[model samples]
Target: MQKKNNYHFETRAIHEGETGDGWSGATLPPIFQSAAHYHESAESLSKTFAGETQDHIYMRLSNPTNRFLEQKLAALESGAGAVATGSGMAAINNACMTLLRSGDEFVASRSLFMSSYTLFTTIFKKYGIRVRLVDPLNLDDIEQAINEKTRFVYMETITNPGMEIADIKQIAQISHTKGIPLMIDNTLASPWLCRPIELGADIVLHSTTKYLSGHGGALGGVVVDAGNFDWTRERFSDFAPFVEQRGRLAFLHRLFKEIHVNFGTTPAPLHSYLTAIGLNTLGLRMERHMENAIRVADFLKDQPKVEWVNFPGFEDHGCHEMAKTQFCNKGFGAMLTFGLKDQAACFKFIDHLDMILNIANLGDCKTLIIHPYSSQYISFSPALKNKLADPQLLRFSLGVEHAEDICNDVAQALEAI
Candidate 1:
């Protein structure tokens, strides 16, 4: 879809996907809650199934509302196209499945979403796809990890929970020089905060259920193609199977059209509508979220009781300057991690928070807090635990709420500590 001129980010967010469908001219895109589409005749059905026509055959293949979201998000991420999936893990799995096969490999940052890290190490590895976990902040480590079998380099734009930032431009250059794609999971730094595609990333993936939705209500994910990588440059022989003996659909073309449908992890229409509603206010909400985060980080940094706080926005923290260059005055996103006095203090603070949700989720309009050790990373093995979790860590997803109120809640909770 072509992005029209004069429509700023915020404007595009609100108006990009709305269409004048046959129903009443609704200002918002209507939820196309459908399971299967009817065909006029058997001939038409054959055409649809044979890829001769582009129309929804089943909800598992495509849905109107999801298609609208895919188009809008593709434009937002500065990509050629996008595909939505059931959840963030589904999106990651789809990308991995499309790129890597048995004996193929990929490099990923060790600091990743706990669930995603598990998926890569446990599930993808089980399929003979090897994942080499490295510190993405070190360009040398990334380069060393890549070998002949490596298909791509994957990492989160902003490391999850740890808040470590990656030098995307440098990584992109390294990957491109080696004739490989640089795939980044951009959930932590949403499009509002950073666009990895512009920095030469080949593909950008998102768990839209997070900051993009700006709410915890919806569940969905997206994989956007930057359209920058030249698939014709043939380093990957896996593209051979997709070619079908004809020069028809190249690498990504076949993946998006065929593999996506065959896998059948398509996102639902209602979820897409909710995600659209959340995206419209993304810029505004992120602004407040960033502001609140800076305040919270500053507050925690000064607390003697607080052992340490890690936020890319804070100058003392690692990667603060890099974050300043990457994230436009958005102050390095709303997530910040801190070490409290003890486990007892962690529970006390969580229990005292009257306004914030103490759920295992993040990026909601309301502030959300979690003790990562007991919640998200609980399943990690002793060895993996050393790599994934910090015992004293308390992760906070600062929301758009008043900074003073948030601080007061933390203050009362700390007093109990």
Candidate 2:
């Protein structure tokens, strides 16, 4: 499919990157699963390896099926280019490694996904990269955290478990003032709900294992470059050569050539195919997800067993207005964290639920629930755990199931608790 600038999001979602098979006339892209492609001549193969021609050399570098998904994701996020990865953590690692050298630092929102927090504090720290965690809503704290070695600012569109929304545009302005890019993890607010690049993000990432796949089957991730950041500034002297060579494509060039390729974070072609199929129905699935979420939030709010709901769709949420403005009032996201009476009630409710799955993953077609304190945030220290998790809190990922049935299941589960 040829991407037309005038195409609406729904049309682009289904048609943007799909170039139908010329050989079989298949409307859907077929998975090119071969580990390597044969060239007609040794000269052509040499040219490809030498960067004089474009061709797949090995599965570790690229695949046709993954390329198709990358194009679609880049188009959907309004980015210039994308690199698909084996997992969301790989995308994060690739982005960080591409930008930050050893001993350099980056600022990130404290309310990050558990694995991300672990990656920054443990893995990246072990490699000598320093990470400063700040409150996304506090501009003063973010400003204070930045230093001469700061490479970029990172935050999620909507935080995990906490459900807080960051002001991307404001943070981008702050980051740009210091000659640093703004990298956003847009997993929760998938491209269907928010395009962070359009909101001034220089780099956007997603764990396609979640909503983009719409099923909990495939594990994949992607980093999309907006192609807008100026990498020629004095603060980023390291990127000068890439900027001179690739111009607006400098970030993608560095990411693909340095971090992604070297680390071998390439995703499987079969997983990419499954993700593409899921994205075709993203607009439809997100609509149902939002609808079901609102209904579920309302039901939980009225229940006497529920202590409080932290969904942004609720008017009382601190970032509710910001979410509406940023998401264009389409819908607040489907993820929510609600508090019950205590840890026992939380576990009992989760265990008693009939319809909702008690799983660690989110963004499945069926409702999923998890207790973050014990599952996702188990490694956090007491102070860190208090900041990001609660013993009585339950994180819920609403699905496209009927609203009434979901509510009934929750009600029965609460009653049992």
Candidate 3:
């Protein structure tokens, strides 16, 4: 799919970044699974290795299948360039390693995926990098946390389990004032619901393992450079070499050459192929996911056994208006969290479900549910857990299945409880 014209998202999702096979005329991208490419002459190989020409040097650096996937993702997110990673954590770690050094710091939204929290507090902390956790909705807290050492600001488009929406445009402006970029974790919203780059994000990250792949099969991640932020600044002095060489592509160039290459976070070609195939129907799948999610959220709101419901689509949700404005009134995401009578009740409800799978993964073709308190947030202290996780909370990832069937499963499970 060559980006021939300015097409709609649905069309771009299917057509962009895919050039049909010259030999076989295959509509879909073929998996290029070779470990290394052979060059006709030693001089050509040397030139390729020296960065004098564009060629695949090794699987750890790049692959044709992966490049195809990157192009599609960048186009979808309205980014200048993108890099595929081994997993979601790899993407986050790659970005952090490229930007932050010893004694440097970064500000992040308090409501984050448990693994992300762990990565910052445990892994990054060991390297002498400081992370300040602040409320995404509180600009004052974000501004107060920033100092000379702050490298960038980070937040999720839709928080995990909590479903809170951040004001990306406002946060981007705040980050720009201090000459730092805003990085958004857009795994939940996907490009179908929101493009963070369009909303003023400088860089966008995603766990393609989730909604982008649309199936729970492939584990992959991507980092997109929006090409809007200027890296030639005193704060980002480390990027000077890349900025001098690549200009607007400095961030992505540094990401590939400095961090991702050494970290060996390159995704497998087969996984990239799967993700590309999954993305073709992303628009269709998200529509049904949102539709089913709203019905499920509404149904849970009126249930006697349900203690509380937190879905951004609901009018009473604190972030509903912000979500509407940012997402252009698109359907609220498929993920939601609701409270039960207690932890035991939550476990009972999950155990009684016949159709929805009890699993840790989300954004699957089949509906999935998980007890976040026991699974994702099990290591947090009680105080931190109280601030982040609900003891009775059950996070649900609604699939594209019929809304009535999904509601019936929940009703039966609640009745069993």
CA lDDT for candidate 3: 0.92
The whole-model lDDT of each prediction reads 0.83, 0.91, 0.92
lDDT winner, 1 or 3: 3
- Model 2: colliding residue pairs: 1-18, 1-19
| Candidate 3 weakest ten by summed lDDT | 18-27
| lDDT per residue (tens digit) for residues 1-417 in model 3 | 236667889888998886744427777788888999889999999998888887887899888899999999999999999999999989998887889999999999988999999899888999999999999999999999999999999999999887999999999999999889999999999999999999899999999999999889999999999988899888888888999888988999999999999889999999999999999999999999999999999999999999899999999899999988998988889999999999999999999998999999999988999999888888889888887788889999999999999999999999998
| Local accuracy of candidate 1 as per-residue lDDT tens digits, 1-417 | 345757877778776764735547665678878799988999999988877887878888877788889988988887877888878878888887888888888999988888888888898878898999999889999999999899999989888787999999999999999889999999888888899999999889999999888778889999988867766556666576555532432545656666677888788788888898899899899889999999999998888889989888877777988898887656788899999877778888788777878888888889989998877777778777866787788899998989999998888778777
Task: Give the distance in Å from residue 218's predicted Cα in candidate 3 to where it truly belongs.
Answer: 0.3
Query: What is candidate 2's lDDT per residue for 232-259, written digit by digit as tens?
Result: 8888888888998789889899999998
Error of 1 at 124 (Å): 1.7
Best-performing candidate as measured by lDDT: 3
TM-score ranking of the models: 3, 2, 1
Backbone Cα, N, C clashes tallied per candidate: 0, 2, 2
Error of 1 at 164 (Å): 0.7
Give the range where candidate 1 is weakest over 10 consecutive residues by summed lDDT: 243-252
